[model samples]
Target: HGSNIEGMLEAVELADGNPLHLAHINAYCRGTVLPEAEETELALKALAANPNISCESYLSPLNGTSAEIIDGLPGSMVTRRCLKTGGFTEDEAGMEAALLSGWAQVNYPQGQEMTLLTGEAARDYWRGQQTLVSVSFAVNPVGPRVRLATAKKADGSFAVDAVSTDGGGIPRNVLLAAGLALVDLGGLSLQELVAKISYQPARLLGLANKGSLTAGRDADITIVDRLQHSAFATIIGGQVCYMDGKVLGRGGRIITTAAGADYVRSQGLEPLVVDLADSSLLQKAQKR
Candidate 1:
């Protein structure tokens, strides 16, 4: 995450103005490989200058990676990365031993039980698993997290476009409560809050009818308890899906990219076209 931001920015620059959506950039600036504060400043500067790039950050302190993806050997860059910040051993045997010794947590099946594997058990699991296996790591810190979340233009609008959970089924979803918490701390205003969680993300995705409450827009919405900092109710397409911790509905449709564009065009729905190379989020900073 540390110097990865530098490399990612370089790639964006090399893309010759192609649109790029960077994910969980706060994790990259937290200084796993480079100094945190320095990298954060550099990242902010790069983002301010690049209108083509938009990114999101999650509020959680933990970031995750797949154990199956690591090379799991001495002298491998991934192995070195794990060893440097994640307390992994230098070699494959060491990694196995570390896994057995509770050095790494394995994401198991069933309820996604996080079991600490060790010794032969860990080695065996690694050897046997054909599909992907994931591991959690605490690679983020508060300094970069806060800085990325609050980055702003001269006009005080947020520079980091959105706050995403980046969590689907892995249970790391913290966008709702965490965003509300940020509002309570004066880190962001309510309108800005809406921008970060709803408007901005919708804009990023080119979902013209999803982010706002205006007529003809989708009724997908969530009501949050200001006092509790939690979701009070959930609505989707003018239907009450959930309220008071009870799910009132279940069923959703998945739209593939090809199908999505086709449906929109067939319906004569001209959604807003987002500029991938120059997002509205960085307008002020880019102007300055």
Candidate 2:
């Protein structure tokens, strides 16, 4: 599971005769080598076609972009350095450098050119420089050319705009609080990513009774509120438990004894009966 594609393929072949609950294929994008887009698409299609296989792609935007070194001393100096090295024009290099340095106002769709440096080439570019800038740069002809500004709106809310970042959509859900941080940074919304985590794992595990909210089945529910950006409650097996917000207790008849009391009496602790004085335990038990 941790090795190369050949090793993973070998493992999958070994597991073919058995049941595989989950299998995560590591598709590292090393400057678009090996698992290229075409190869990855084919692999995914093939995997999906297999009845026993469920595949997940761990993609990162950092792998597709060209790397560039920018000087921080001055915009002009950085521009000249980039141009002299035959990597980027003065304006392009200046804009890129400024963007990297927290200045996202250089301009839109700047024609910044940089050698697609990797391996030894990338290392050599940073060897002598005191501070070298490197970013995974992707160039696509379809979308807008300018980088979105990471600024707040007039109402103090974050401006909604798309900007490029690293990592696949998978880790944005299962990685704990870091996932929320990634979402806040415009990587992906928690709700959108959590849905993938909820269903994809179930499908991979081949669990027909779970992974969804439907009738005539165990109540496996994950209640979330879009406004709060968190799971407010969860229900399982017809039991519900509040997680984030408080729910007031309602009036109900207390069950002093039940038919199951005989089973406890058989254990010889005590044949006792108690009122339902506390409801929290009942609430939590219902959730399970």
Candidate 3:
């Protein structure tokens, strides 16, 4: 992430033309960082000036943060920042108040899925969990979010390289739903949306086998219901992993560094070795 406009600029300077993929770019433009509009503008300008810096942003307004309070204060710097953003104290009492007021929502488990809970029940659930749970706040500003996602570079490439779901923890994995809405309104072409969400992301991760429908590409695919604007099914490595809101596949390969391979095997999972030298980021560094 570009944590903020300055953070993004600093990282770019530090990279010095090496490839840098910034995730959740919208998180940095929430008015807390140099006013939302200026932050968005600077972020886009930086991306355009530096093709070495790739970027992604989510569509959700609610952002994930730690609910854990330590020694009377929020444990995470992000949590403290969020509390201040909502005009609350940077303490435990403020978190409780935020939850009670619905400015904060607890991400609690409901059946096998995670759902957002606000109001009294949310505060209760959070207390029951000893404030160790994760919570989300509606902190992302709309204008910056939109601009960051749709900006174009000088060479006609996407300023923000992808639309990523910084979800799982916050449950705002609405990539297709939100992205397709942009396509429907002609803010983005279908191909552009796919390239942002799929093609470029694959490059960021160095997933050479995925991201395309070309003849020999891996059969990793997601079928979306355009009318409903939701994921219908997912196929990974030619196997059905998810269908009809159910996870069908038991296990998936863990892509990790060589040092993590032993731990992954100990957990009875296969690890796909990732050499840092081969990463696109480091490859650029090598060329430089």
Candidate with top TM-score is: 3
RMSD of each: 5.4, 19.2, 2.1
154-266: candidate 1 lDDT, tens digit per residue? 66667688887665455456677777888888988888888888888776665667778999888899988899888889999889998998889875654334436566666
| C-alpha lDDT of residue 28 in model 2 | 23
Model 1 score (lDDT): 0.67
**Model 3 ranges off by over 4 Å:** 276-278
**Order of models, best lDDT first:** 3, 1, 2
Who wins the lDDT comparison? 3
Q: Pairing residues by index, what is the TM-score of model 1?
A: 0.77
My TM-score estimates for the predictions, one after another, are: 0.77, 0.33, 0.92
lDDT by residue for model 3 (96-204), tens: 9999988888998998789999899998888888889999999988787778778887677778878887675557877788889888988899898899889877766
234-284 per-residue lDDT for model 2 (tens digits): 665566654566543332222225554677666654433443322222322
* Per-model lDDT: 0.67, 0.37, 0.82
Clashes of each: 6, 5, 0
